[model samples]
Target: MTQITFKQGWRQLISGLADLRLAIILLLSIALFSISGTIIEQGQSVSFYQNNYPEDPAILGFLSWKVILTLGLDHVYTTWWFVTLLVVFGSSLTACSFTRQLPTLKSARRWQYYKRPSQFEKLALSTELSYLTLDQLIPELKQHRYKIFQEGNQLYARKGIMGRIGPIVVHISMLIILVGAIWGAFTGFMAQEMVATGETFQVKNIFEAGKLSKAQIPQDWQVRVNDFWIDYTQEGEIDQFYSDLSVVDLKGNELKQETIHVNQPLRYDGVTFYQTDWGIAAVTVQINNSPIFRLPMAKLNQEGEGNLWGTWVPIKPDLSQGVSLLTRDLKGTLLVYDTAGKLTGVVRPGMGIEVEGITLKVQKLIGSTGLQIKADPGIPIVYTGFGLLMVGVVMSYVSHSQIWALKVDNSLYLGGKTNRAQVGFEQEFLAILTALEKQQPQLVTSSSEKG
Candidate 1:
């Protein structure tokens, strides 16, 4: 009795999980949360949320930094409730496949020949015909790609068995997709790096990462920015920026090298580096035959013009006086300013300007490349799942048709049915009957000749 009760409970659990309405509700809830994730900006800092979703004018009346952090809306895909939804949806698919699709496939695979003429009358399409035998009907069914089975005077045939397997494949594909999503959520990481020209560094500034993403981060490799440059259009506007990158090992041995631009990325060892931004890093300058010094440039945020970088160069050895040097592009031009915020002069690379009775020479401008790096281990699985899903959808459209026949006292009882495309299947059934009808006189004549 205990065993029976356990079995009943298990069966009921499976049945409840296999409910179509429940699956739809879970799917919709997942979509809703995903939309919220998109709208609320994932993986942003607390200060960013504090500024964007302030309490005084909370977005949607109740959305604020506190609410967002409490609900894990800052990273919805990795949230506990979101992941639970995915797991439950996957369980529902598995239960539906085992409890419904597999059983349906099993039933479709089991074919039987009807021994009684009365069996034909129970079909959706049934008719009584004269001058028909298994020998004449066999070729017609075979031409239509039916798999035939026989038992003395009764015959059975079926076609499109893939239609029965389609639902099962679809369920399996959906489960695979869910697994890929969960795996990516737990194993993938994203990071941004801004390296100056001729700089080599390891990935350390991780902005967003999963709990299990430590393995995905490169620990034994380093990336080198060999060079960074930009192309300008004829109108002096920026066109595109390029980064010459090299992948190296801990011993400084080069593993791979590539030149990447916007929409083109360098990929090595499962990690991809995408060129996303560019900036003026520094400028080289000399004062009155002094040794050349590299000055780091700082970016200034302006309202409407464009990007600008500036640096202050001290002229006096006492560190009491300095001149501000600013540039808007990497075209080697520098704008000099005095301590009183007055523009002194404009100079270019290899050109000189006298500042406080000393000649200041402007040299080359150094550029930096901003790269976004990511590693996703589940992409291949997701792609393969989608491929199987397409195949399953096409297979599901094919109608599974079955036909039965019994020879009884000089008359043939014929009937058939299909799971889909009812009108088309009826026409096909009539066409087969018409083809058998056309051969009747010829069969009789052949019989007479045989006699």
Candidate 2:
């Protein structure tokens, strides 16, 4: 009695797991959580959500900063609930593929040769040749490349088994993609650096990292910005910029080098370095008859603002009178303003202009490059899953067709069915029937000879 109850409960569990409706619900739930992951910025500081989603006027009328933090909206992909959702969805796909798709594929491959005339009559495309035998139909079906099975006078022909395997492949591919996403969530890191020209640095400024991301992060290598420069248009407008970068080992031996630009990145050992933004690092100026002095330029605007660097150049030993020099970029244009709030002159690098009767020479401008680097171990696996998905979709287009033949008494019955493309399959079955009818006498003579 206990064993019977256990069997009943196990069957119920499998039934629930293999339900189409349940699988669809799980898929939709996964998509909904994925959308939330996209909508809520992931891997952000507590202050970020606090500043954006305030308490008085919330983001969506009820979503406060505290709510976002408690719900793990700042890092949705790595959250326990989100990972559980993915694992559950993957389990549903696996269960459905095993209990549903695999059995259907096995049923399609099984050769169920028709024995009675009524069996053929039940098919969508069924007919009988009054004077035909199974021998005639076998050759024509074989010519059509249909896989045939025979037992005495009965025969079965089938083709396009790929249709049976397609859904299974698609389900497995989605599972693989889910695994890849979960793997990457626990083994990827993103970092950013604003290195000046000719500066070598290690990966230190990490904005985002996964739990097991140490293996993905670079520790034994360092990167150097050999040079950073911008390409300017003829109208002095900014064009694309580039950074000459080099990767070195722990002992400072160069291993690889590349010149990266906007939309182009350097990749080495699974780590990618993208040239994102640029700024002016420093300015060299010669005032009056004095020697050249290099001064650091500070960005006047915050993040996302236009690049504008400025510094003050003192003209006297007492530092009482000085000119404020402002430049947009490393294009060598500097605006000189007097201490009395008067526009003085526009000077370029290597050119000296009289500012309050004192010669102010702009010497050289140094450029800095902002690079965003990232490493994800599961990216290759994700790409492989996508490739398998495409192949599976193509396979799904093939129709799973089955043909049964039986020679009963004086009549030979032929009928076939397909899981998809029914109209086209009907036309093909009719052609096969017509061929059998036209060669009825020859088919009977051949069958008699074989028997």
Candidate 3:
């Protein structure tokens, strides 16, 4: 009795999980949470959230930085709650497939011959014809491409069985997609890097990483920025930027080289680097017969104007007197400023300007490339699942129709039904009945001689 009760409980659980309404609700909930993830920027520092979502004037009157952090909104995709939702939803799909879709498909494949004339009356379309033979009906069903089965006097035919299998395929595809999403959430990582020209660096500055993402981070190789440059339009506007990058091994051997721009990226060892941004790194200058020096440039916030980079150069050995140099582009134009913040002179590359009894010659401006790198191993599985999903959707559109014919005492009882496309199925059934009617005279003469 205990074993029977346990089995009943298990069956009830499966049946509840297969409910269509429950599946729809879970699907909508997942979509709502995913939208929240997009709205709340994922993978940001605590200071960023504190400044953006202050407690005094919380967004939506309730969402503050404290609330965001407490709920793990900074990295919503890998959150425990989000992962749990995925697992539960996947279980629902699995139960529905086994308890509903699979059983329906199995029932459709099995032969179901109508042995009594009363069964014909229960169908959507049924008819009676005198002196009709199974041999005559077999030819008509074959012409319609229907698979036939006969037992003594009862006959059954069916077509478009793929329509029954389509739902199962769709369920399998959903399960595959869910598995891919969960796997990626636990194994992928994202990082950003700002590399200057002629500089080699390894992957660091990771802002987001899954629990199992350590192995995904590149530790065997490094990347070098060979050069960085930008193209300007005739109107002095920025057109595009390019970065020539090389993949190198530990011993500094070049493994690959490519020029990447906005949409193009470099892929190596399961990690992908995308060109996202650019900036001025530093400027090289010569202090009148002295050794060349590379001074780091910093971006200045100027209202109304675009990006501007500035740096200070000391003309005196004691560093008591200096000049502020600023530029808006890599075209070698430099705006010089005196110690009192007055405009002193405008200098270009290889040109010298006198300041504080010393000459400073402007050299070339160095540029840096901003790259967003990511590693995702589940992308292929997700793509394949989507492909199978499309095939399943197309197959589900075909109608699964079945026909039954029972010859009883010189009269033919015929009936047919379809899972979908009722109007089309009815028309086809009528056409077969008309064909049989046309052969009624020949059938009558043969029946009379046999009697």
Instruction: Score each candidate by Cα lDDT.
Output: 0.90, 0.85, 0.89
lDDT of 2 by residue, 121-226 (tens): 6777776677777787888898777998999999889999999899989998888899999999889988989999988999989878889999888889999899
TM-scores of all predicted structures: 0.93, 0.92, 0.93
User: Pairs clashing in candidate 2?
Assistant: none
- Tens digit per residue, CA lDDT, model 3, 280-301: 9999998889999999999899
Give the poorly placed runs of model 1, Cα more than 4 Å off: 303-305, 441-451
By lDDT, the better pick of 1 and 3 is: 1
Which regions in candidate 3 have their CA more than 4 angstroms from the true location?
303-305, 354-357, 438-451
Best by lDDT: 1
TM-score of 2: 0.92
Highest TM-score model number: 1
Error of 2 at 20 (Å): 2.7
